[model samples]
Target: MEFKNGKITKGFAFLDTYELTVLMKAKKTSKAMKNTMEETQGYLGMWVTEDGYIRHELLPNNRYDEDRGKRESAYQGRYKVTGNHIEYIDDTGFTADGDFVDEKTLHHGGYIFHKKLE
Candidate 1:
């Protein structure tokens, strides 16, 4: 960096290929984080199977709680939704994913879910 008259004259740093790639990846990750935060709001609520067996709740803080049968909190995890695709990482290290068929419908693990009405 060079400075003249108390102002920056040359302030750019040239990066190597690996450094540039890392920087780009960091930028992309930041953008994806922002998008996930925004998109999660629209998906925050309870989604359930028709028989009410599986109850999945997407909380405001990007964490989820799922109840199966009579088991409350059968699964608890953090989740990220990119576009209409959702990925889950359970507290016990189990992983799963799902897709939104529409605004109110989700399909995961060979089961279909609908947004539960309040």
Candidate 2:
């Protein structure tokens, strides 16, 4: 059983039944604090942050059908882009390289990265 929105929402029972629900709440964000959060499009992607992070793709959408074997990965790791080159250091201690074709596209580890859209 559980409480939702400060009230009991559901429950179930058996031959010998006991149930307890805890209602927890978080302080509501102030209007000013809420406005600050809207300043960043955080969900767009981590590309906004300079510190390197790995974004991996498993199945190809449309542009990656030819590289299905490359999409197979038992391990993955972080990446860094310098100039036109992007380097990937896999978790297994293997270093590989690729190229960034454009600002919104990167070809790395036999996979492609594009600016994701909602």
lDDT of 2 by residue, 7-117 (tens): 889987664223222211122335333432113222123221122233443221111111123344445565554555655666667877766555456566655666444
- TM-scores vs. true structure, each candidate: 0.66, 0.34
Error (Å) of candidate 2 at residue 24 is 60
Which residue pairs show collisions in model 1? Answer: none
lDDT of each: 0.87, 0.43
Clashing pairs counted in every model: 0, 0
Least well predicted 10-residue stretch by lDDT in candidate 1: 33-42
- The CA-based lDDT of model 2 is what? 0.43
